[model samples]
Target: MKINLRKSLICINQQKLIAIFLVFMFLGFTLAKPEFASSYSINNILCTMALYGIASLGMTLVILTGGTDLSAGSVMALSGVIGAGLLGKAFSAANPVSLPFAATVLIALIFSGLIGYLNGIVITKLKIAPFVATLAMMSIARGLVYVVADSVVQGVSGSPITFMNDGYSLLGQGKIGAVPVQFIVYVILFLIVFVFLKYTRTGRSIYTVGGNIDTAKLAGIKTNKIIVLTYTVSSILVGISGLILVGRLSSASTVAAKGYELDFITAVALGGTSVAGGRGSVIGTLLGTAFLAVLNNGLDIVNVKSFYQYLIKGLILVFAVCADLFMNKRVKKS
Candidate 1:
């Protein structure tokens, strides 16, 4: 009981510190660029957070199990392309074909889930390291994007597929009074995941597996299934993000969401989630997502060069990983 209490306190303290830092960062940005304080800029920041938060939530789950999915970015692109194709935007102008929004989403989820399942099988059955397995999947998915694009587009094998339905696009761009639809989707996903992780048996199993797979198996937890489920779930979330992204951009391309896996890792780690696994929260991930979004928006407002922004973000990621490792070591000692 005492140990659990101590851990809880530590978690709260870390979250508080992150919150304080976020407030200070926001204020500094607003002061530096007064325009940033405007409602428009604030909305944009929230939108950015939502875009990244959706994927990071899934990443938090996979990472919690001591596994990582480097193919999330590629999966996002693949799902987007497939979803666009199913939406019938790629059909002939004279013979336009379109499916319901629900169908499009379902198709994308299933396709993405299949890819995620493949990642799981490779890791579990073949005994491949998570990093190497996911890296291979990343390449496979990226390469397949051209094949999907070719089937959708007539001339170019890698051309972008445009989504023409305004209603479909509304999922990404619509606002309910003042709240953006995309952010609403993020909040909904966050709440569902938060409850799942905090209040469900399977969620506990995920933590158990990440903390120690052998121990989990000894306890009859079916660790393999848990791992596969986590990867599949992560991919489904990525697929959802892909749809939202396509709606937002009104187009899907093979290059969409390129290099986002690194950003997802950075967000999960920044949220105080140990890279070694077994400790983290949905709320913390959300805060971390906001931090990254705000930092990028603020940097842009301050006219920071793109190259400098990349350097700063990369340094921040390194610091986050180091911090997580240090914290994990301390917890073990305690």
Candidate 2:
């Protein structure tokens, strides 16, 4: 009965639970460290939300389709490096020839999306597992970043490319009045993706495919195409995040975005997205993103050590996954 009741609550009030938890966390943090409630702190958390939220939205889509992209962080790094090489000063501080900002962004996105497309092909055509395929892609993409950066810099094999262009910086650092430009961009992207998932035939197909590919095929849905498109869309969103991160840091390195996949996956899982696929919402992901942003900020404000933070986050992920499994089992039994 306790399990049934817990499952009932989760099924009916998953988003509400997330919202309540976020509120409690905020309140608790504010009480613990009054500085956490400061305007600057609030703005910082919001910016972090925008950054992680955008990528988490993409992860939500892929997770909903019963697949995961471990390559997201590496893909972002590759895209950021490519963008730095193009729109910012050349990879070398010496040559320093910058291209049009729009063109550079366009090229980076295309390249990242292509990587995702290839990942999809390997999974669909070669019948490889999503985990193995994306893991291989992650290593390949990271290595490519080193190769590309070294080629551009001519001596900087492992050094970061510093590109502090005003236009690039504006994307991550600029404000519209008091609101971060990145946050505004994140909102726009979120709305667009939400609408697509809610209203489009292809979007519906994604859910069907994830739920049961054989059933989806029987229904005449192009399961392979849907899977591929989900991955491609995910990588494009990762590119957006990479571009913003590069703008924020004013540089790109092969090491950038390392371990970001953990954060993304954690946010998606906490948002109530089933790792088994076929159930999730973009809005839930936003809330989940906000929850982590606040948690991290709170920890920082309270001077929590980095090691403890990692431990806490890891434990939370385990708990979230266990909860998901329990809920899924209940659903199946019912």
Candidate 3:
């Protein structure tokens, strides 16, 4: 009875452990730099959290299915360039296309979803590993960024597409009272995903697919469809993030969101999600993203060099993966 109780306690306390660590880290940062607690800095952290957190949520979904998306950053860039290029503005002098904001956003999301669908089809139909398949898509999407930029902006093949649109900008920069609109959107998305994963039939099937593909298949679940659906949803969320980024910057560069995939994966891993799949939560991911946002902002506040920041984040990722492996072993033993 004691051992059984201990096992249940372990399961319950994992998320709390992360939350406690986050609080301690926040306190430590505040002590090291007094200004770290300032409202401006806090708001900055929340904004960063929202920007990356939205994509990380999608990443959480992908990882939960024992898959990874190397193309997310590229997809984000693609979406941004595509959306910005299509806007009815004089941003890109070479591009003659102009569309309403809603149309532009819809078109961008559709393309993103298509890319994700192809990824899933390749993984399922071609029997390619997710890593290899997504790696290929990453290259393809990035190359398309350059291609799209060249086609739209003509002579300035690689230049950023700068635009001025107040309505679009509001998505990233507007605030409701003291809170940012983007952050609010992030929260809404988080709650929606949480409810979906916890309450929906398809959501539960994702877990079963990730936990044991063969068993899921035997249980009469269409594993392929579930995988495809998760990937599609992941890309669409990433597309939304891309649009928000463009709004915030008022520009979309060919290199926008470059290498951001690492940050998303790191956030999901640090949040206690299993790389092996089948055990994790969006709540854990939210906490993990908060921890990362604080760490980055705090590091900048203390004037830490970018190189060292990279090293520190890399170490944390390694540690998180190791810890996850250890926990999985313990759970199996119990």
lDDT of each: 0.85, 0.87, 0.87
**C-alpha displacement of 237 in model 3, angstroms?**
0.5
- 227-306 per-residue lDDT for model 2 (tens digits): 89999999999989999999999888879999898789889888878889998888889988998999899989999999
Best by TM-score: 3
Model 2 spans > 4 angstroms off? 1-12, 88-91, 94-97, 320-334
Sorted on lDDT, best first, the list reads 3, 2, 1
lDDT of 3 at 66: 91
Q: Pick out the ten consecutive residues of candidate 1 with the lowest summed lDDT.
A: 89-98
Write one digit per residue (lDDT tens) for candidate 1, span 1-334: 9978878776534455567778998899888999988889888887888888999999999999998999999999998888887778654422155677788789888999999999998999999999999999999999988887777777756778875877557877888888899999899999999999989999989999999899999999988899899999999998888888888887888899999999898888788787788888878899889989989999999899999998988886676556556765776687
Model 2 pairs whose backbones collide = none
Q: Please report how far candidate 1 places residue 8 from its true position, in Å.
A: 7.3
- Candidate 1 vs candidate 2: the lDDT winner is 2
Candidates' RMSD to native: 2.8, 3.4, 2.3
Lowest lDDT 10-residue stretch of candidate 2: 88-97
Task: Tell me how far the alpha carbon of residue 214 in candidate 1 is from the true structure, in angstroms, after superposition.
Answer: 0.8
Ranking by TM-score: 3, 2, 1
Model 3 regions lying over 4 Å from their true place:
1-14, 90-92, 321-334
What TM-score fits each model? 0.91, 0.91, 0.93
